[model samples]
Target: MDLERPVQIVWQGPFTLAAAIASSTAPSKGVYQIYGQHIVFGPNSLLYVGMTDGQTFGARLAQHRDRWLVHEDDVTIRLGVVADLDSSARLADIEALTIWWHSPPYNSKNIWTYGGGPLRIQNLGARGRLHPEYSSHWKPARTPPDGEHP
Candidate 1:
């Protein structure tokens, strides 16, 4: 991945699984965001950020629907299709950066440590609650002073 160029993600939809499956433009591999009610963030809050490698967006979202449908909140999904990516690593980098930046309630990993180097992501179209751009870089761990115990 080129650190200089921002990865462009073309976002579409706050759709249900059935709707996404029916859509002609949805991609098979990309990052997705799940939105619904949250105890704290309330209605239409971003609940999770996830990526699909080999599976279609419909299939990936079906899995989430199985898990989330039991709850009372209505689940909606938004797909982020990368407009310029060289490899799957770029896809994972996008997912990691999005999760790290957004800190969605259901996403537990990649909030602290991510494998990729510095990356900048540009979200285009229907971003919803996500930032328009994200620049991800490593942050040094804080160390306590000589007499202090953490």
Candidate 2:
């Protein structure tokens, strides 16, 4: 399950799609990390983790421009090119692993009481095995209103 690979610094420091165009590190496909100010777990200060297969990292970043964190001026972006060909599944797996590990607020599909705080899961199965307490925490993700996408 290790997707360890070298990642280039595609874009950083209050990222915007317009910035990606000026930077040479922009990658066409791979994983991306969105960092927020507060540290949630360990030394990793991540707000979201995402993967791009058929789209450019710039395009993907643009899609998230209106997210909650976008309102923050300190948010940054880092992108890595998918080194392996035909590794879309692996990239998806890595995305899940990252979200589970960091539990970023925006990734929360379902909120559960865990570790004396709320736990968010973008993909429950990706969480793999869990402690017995989590069984009681299963909750569905909130649906957006009337054709809106959250």
Choose the strongest candidate by lDDT: 1
Write model 1 residue lDDT over 1-150, tens digit each, in one string: 666788888888878756875666557778988888899999999989999888888777777767764573777878888986678887888898888777787887876656777798889999989989878764435453587443
> For candidate 1, what is the lDDT?
0.79
lDDT of each: 0.79, 0.48
Instruction: Report residue 59 deviation for candidate 1 (angstroms).
Output: 0.6
lDDT of 2 by residue, 12-125 (tens): 344543574345556656666776566444332566667777877776777787545457545666665544434565555445544445456667632222222222222222
TM-score of each: 0.84, 0.52
Most TM-score-accurate candidate: 1
- Separately for all candidates shown, the number of backbone clashes (residues 3 or more apart, or on different chains) is 0, 0
Which stretches in model 2 have alpha-carbon errors above 4 Å? 1-18, 21-25, 38-44, 67-69, 109-150
